[model samples]
Target: MATNRATKSGFAAEAQRKVNAKYSEELAQECLEWIRTITNEDINCGGDMDNFYEVLKDGTLLCRLVNCIQSGSVKKINNTTMAFKCMENINAFLETAKVLGVPAQETFQTVDLWERQNLNSVVICIQSLGRKAGNFGKPSIGPKEAEKNERHFSEDKLKAGQSIIGLQMGSNKGANQSGINFGNTRHM
Candidate 1:
């Protein structure tokens, strides 16, 4: 008899355990609440991975969430259950997130959410979106977004910068070769 994924012990199970360690229930609850409030629709999904995957697998809610963040981010949300259409919606949402300054590393692949391969990644993607919401002057779900600090340099500062070399590129401004000479140096 063949065992199902839930019972089978394998690499998938090990990976899931590792990811689960990093998953935060508090954050997930916040993400769900934010989604509901922003889209004005209650998500039937829960903090559980299985339920979360099932609801988001269709990608309709994800599209709606993105559109709420930025109007017209996702033009068409497929209501049909076709696999490709669902994937398209997920892909569109991810693309919109990237365009809006969400780091690519923080996003998930289509299969990660659709196939339930990595639901934690999906949560992380959602959390990243929440953090970025402030860019649009919208409410956020997770921690407050970090503000951008742009520094301005005067003409003198800019000229001084041209004459100085950055320390990263082997700029030996001070003493060297004082006590630790190697490679066939006779001892004094």
Candidate 2:
């Protein structure tokens, strides 16, 4: 007889750990309410089923947001459309920052704020809080930019960019923003 290697119910889902760190329950509730309310909106799925699904896969991610909302680890800023854009998903946690209350436009206007304020952490938080959030809209580098920088490209790479390859050159930021990465094809 073979020993049982697989277990049912996914090996008894991990137990919920107590939230040891301090968190604002009120803010989390507000964020969840926002997600729930949006779920019932035109963007939910029924209005533009295809696009909505394209944006928010099933209601599963939305549900996880609700749980985070109930946890009060997130908050809302005046509850406006722009606010929704900035803090709609896991990004809501950033809304708790005092500056977030100062209107989304101004708060996000300064690139320095994004860099110094740890916007990357906000992005990571969104990724962790929901099934998928930060992964959305990751820039894709194109072949043209790649050829412009790579200094040497085979026939394949040249054909991909309509050039002889290795003939052109470009700046790092230009190549990156173009979504060009010789090492990573996932962006392609």
Candidate 3:
């Protein structure tokens, strides 16, 4: 009986390995790049917002990345459909930026200082999205209280991490909440 159980277990393991092997490192990198592109297009920190061409170009690239992700060519690393939907919204925002003609390299500088500033903005947005997703398993639906908490958490996180977004008294109060308070958010 033990031998039979071992054989069954081995078979199941092999099947799981096969499934895992289908998702390659290249695919994972593509997903990450797509996410980064979307974030860069959506968020910005103080810098050079002067180049119309670069902004438009970056917005276009951002839109393309979103299109690929939503087309299902790039499978999300996380096994959550809501993530897929978030990607869709991300794509929409990129398109909006493109239409608005936001400059791509607005933060470029002769030195790494400005580049780091821009990169930090991108990182902050991604981290905020990650925290929200982590706290509320479903990006689309969380308890009203949970969503509120996430917003407060995201605000505090951005302020703490980004020098540009310094913590204000309003945000401090929001961050200091002891429990979740669902005033008006809805679950998806």
Candidate 4:
């Protein structure tokens, strides 16, 4: 029994080491520090920390953002329109982070994402929260809330369609009057 237990423990340790080897220890630690700072959670470099690294590797939105930042894919362009579009993407990403349980207000406490220099740091913070939150990050809405939203959208669409039809009818009336005016002017 002792030999069996020892073998099992050895295998577990080996598996952990392999997992740890897959991620950059420096990056993982940096991300953890940001997580601790933002969430005020007491996280360390082992135990639950390993789970953070695992989650970071799992390719969530935060992870993808980090990958984009790290790969130099997201950069400032000279074009104003492109820059505005980039800001829009960042805003959307931040909102998504908030929905995913990232304490976004606290995360941005020390840095502004609009500044290009702070983007990499922002990515680290987001990725850290994504790692810590795991499956809990997904936003949940009750079925009744969803149905209410659907009804509201349908009502808005119906109102828009009615307004468009009214505009078309008004334009047709103007066209009929213009035809009558043209015939009278020709006779005159």
Summarize candidate 3's per-residue lDDT along 38-146 as a digit string, tens digits. 4445533222322211232223333444343334323332222343443443445434333333334322221111122233333233233333333323231112323
Residue pairs with clashing backbones, model 1: none
Q: Which stretches of candidate 2 lie over 4 Å from their true place?
A: 1-43, 46-70, 82-90, 93-188
Off by more than 4 A, model 3: 1-57, 68-117, 127-145, 148-188
Ranking of all candidate structures by their TM-score, best first: 1, 4, 3, 2
Error of 4 at 130 (Å): 2.6
RMSD of each: 4.6, 22.0, 24.2, 21.7
TM of each candidate vs. truth: 0.75, 0.19, 0.20, 0.28
lDDT of each: 0.81, 0.32, 0.35, 0.43
Put down candidate 1 lDDT per residue, 60-105, tens digits, no spaces.
9999988998998888999988778888989999999998888999
Pairs that clash in candidate 2: 27-74, 28-69, 28-72, 140-179, 141-178, 141-179, 141-180
Model 1, backbone clash pairs (residues 3+ apart or across chains), number: 0
Q: Please write out the lDDT profile of model 4 over residues 28-104, one tens digit for every residue.
A: 45665554544444546332433443333212333344323333332332223344554554555455556555565
> Could you tell me the lDDT of residue 4 within candidate 4?
27
| Span of 10 residues, lowest total lDDT, candidate 2 | 137-146
Task: Using TM-score, give the best candidate's number.
Answer: 1
* Residue 122 in candidate 2, Cα distance off native in Å: 12
